[model samples]
Target: MISVVLLGSGNVGTHFFKAIEKAENVRVAQWFSRQIDSIKGYKNKTAITDNLSELMEADLYILAVSDDAIATLSSALPFENRLVVHTSGSVNVHDLDKKNKRGVLYPLQTFSKGAEMDFKNVPICIETLDKKSYPILKEVATSLGSPTKRVNSNQRRVLHLSAVFVNNFTNQLYRIGHEITESEAAEFDLLKPLIMETAKKIQTLSPYMAQTGPAKRHDKKTIEKHLDLLKNPEHKAIYKLLTKSIQNTHGR
Candidate 1:
């Protein structure tokens, strides 16, 4: 069996570890985390260690830590010849020194602890230092039902930025919408249907083609009224700026 020592049992690590455990010919030899108490449950199924040298038995050490800590943690790991892979969307795979076989296994999706993941549907981008490790990485991803794509460093960085705009930025907009409706004693649930429809329409219609609202139609009165209704300075500025941007993008 190909063994894995997972580092940092955070959201990404937790999710990946669970999925990998279910796969054939793969077993988690151990898990490493700073918060040993928090990740103790994982230790019941496999050995869990706080020491770095305990990772020597595993074929690969998957560093699921933050991008900022990748360098320091990679340097701290003791094994020179063991395959080292980091699961990060933005960090370059080459950031790991040439001492070992280094690679990346970046799953392009948001992971929340205790939430189920359908790895089959999520795209997995893989990158590697040498050809020898490609098969191992690809097999690991494919076994989890994820469709694998080998991406270079530059393309992965660009995709990470785009994902942020789509997932993170769009979520903030939803939060803002919820706050605005609640302040008026209106339930945010009322907007759920409209939000669902907007997303569905955009799947088939080009985002520009699916455009609606006052900004698209140049309904100056409605736009002005919305601006007037927004009492908070920050919210009002955001509304105006987004409206102007939307109009500029889709209007004459």
Candidate 2:
């Protein structure tokens, strides 16, 4: 079995650790975290450690820490010239330096604790400075049910930024929708069908063609009504700007 150490227990780390538990030929040899109480459940089979020395024996160390702590934590690890990988999207693999056989194992999707994800469907973005380590990482990724893709550092950065807009921004829009409906005591569940349909359409329709609403048709009366309904200044500004943008794009 290929022994591995995971160095964080946050959202991504927790999801990844659980997913890896189901794969063969791999085992979580050790786990390290500052807050040991949070991960007490994993202390049974996996050696849990707050000290860096316990990480010495593992074949590979996966730093699931934040991008800001990568350099500091890497420098503190007891061993040198061992294989090390990080799971980060915005941070480049090169940031880990040449001290270890550095690589990246970025999952392109958002991870939330307690929410199950299909490892098979999530694309695994893999990168490595050492060519020999690439296949090993690929095999590990495949065994865990992910579709692997080789992405360079620059491409990974762009992909991550795009993910924020598509996932984060869209979720914020949903939250706004919920808030608006709740204020007037309307059921937010009413929007579920529309939400699912909008997402389904994107699979076949170009977003531009699938786009609808008063903004696309230049229904000035509806736009004015929406503006009047919006109580938050920021939300109103956003709605007005987006409407104007959509109108301009469609030549309305």
Candidate 3:
């Protein structure tokens, strides 16, 4: 059995704990949070501590902390030569203090508190400074039923940047759509199907092939109408920028 000490209590950490708790081959030997109350609810399931010195022996130390904290936390670990991995896409594996064996097990997915996540579909990007640590990280990812991909720090950074475009930027566009619908007293729910269909199309069709609507068609009249309808300058600016981007992409 693979035993792990999970150090962090935020969204990624919480979800990791829940998934690990259910995995038969792996178990969380301990959970650490700066403030004990953040993980107090799990006290009944595993050892919880706020002190680094109190951390127990485990097969892996998974630091699911914020990107900024990974280095500091790993440096502060009271032991060395142990397998230590962080769940960060952009942070380099070498960022962890050399006191311990360092690696990364970045789950390439958006995480939010109180949201359900199915690890089986989450692609875990794994990287390790030491060759031997690769299989160990893969085993932990497998324990969560997640598919693993070997990614260098640079590839992971590119994936993370692309994710920001597809997930974060797309969500902001949806918010703008919601605002636009509200301005006309229209139901935003009306656009839900379109959103789902757009997502579904990209599954079987390349995004370039799936492109549609005024910008892709170069319907200048419709584009101008959209700009005129957008009362907010920020929204208009975004619309114009995206329209230009789409037009440029299609050789307009």
Candidate 4:
């Protein structure tokens, strides 16, 4: 069995621990957090520590901390030359201190505290500075039942940027829609089906082919009506920008 030392107790780290708990071939040997209380609940399951020197021997050391902390934390590890990886999409594999074998096991999905995540559905993007580390990281990812893809640092950065557009930006648009509906005393829930249908369409149809509505149709009257209805200048600006973007995409 592959033993893992999980360092960090945030959303990604917490989820990784839970997923590994269910995996048959891998187990978390220890969990580390700056503040022990963050992972106090898991003390019954695995060794938990706040001191780096107390870290036990393990097959893998996963630094699932924030992107900014990866380098500093890796450098501070008491042991070295072991397989060390960080769960960051944008951070380069080489960012880890050269004291150990460095790699990345980025799970390409949004994570939130208290939300349920199915590990089988999350895509794991793997990158390693040393060639031999690839199979080890791949095996760990496979144990989690996640699909693995080999991605270079540059590719991972692009993937992360695209994710921000699709997930973060799209969620902000949903917030704006909620605000608009509330202003008109309309039920925002009424748009739920449309949202789901739009997502479903992109599964079988290319986003370009699935395009619909006023902007895609070049319905200037409807577009103007929307812009006029948006009383908030910020909302109107976003509407205009997105409308222009859609129009340009469709050659309207």
What TM-score would every model get versus the actual structure? 0.94, 0.94, 0.98, 0.98
RMSD of each: 1.6, 1.5, 0.8, 0.8
lDDT tens digits by residue: candidate 1, 65-137: 9999898899888868778999999988878766888999999998898899989877899999889999988
The collision pairs in model 3 are none
In model 2, which runs have C-alpha deviations exceeding 4 angstroms?
A: none
User: Candidate 3: lDDT of 247?
Assistant: 94
Candidate 2 residues 157-238, lDDT tens each? 9999999988999999899889999889999999999999999999999888998999998898999999999998988988
Over 1-252, each residue of candidate 4 has an lDDT whose tens digit, in order, gives 999999999999999999999999999999999989999999999999999999999999999999999999999998878999999988888889998998999999999979989998899999999999999899999999999999999999999999999999999999999999999799999999999999999999999999988999899898888888989999999988988899999998
Model 4 misplaced stretches (Cα beyond 4 Å): none
List ranges where model 1 is wrong by over 4 Å.
none
> After TM-score superposition, what is the CA distance of residue 46 in candidate 4 from its true location, in Å?
0.5
Error of 2 at 130 (Å): 1.3
Name the lDDT value of residue 66 in candidate 4: 96
Q: Model 3, stretches more than 4 Å misplaced?
A: none
Q: Whole-model lDDT, candidate 1?
A: 0.87
Clashes of each: 0, 0, 0, 0
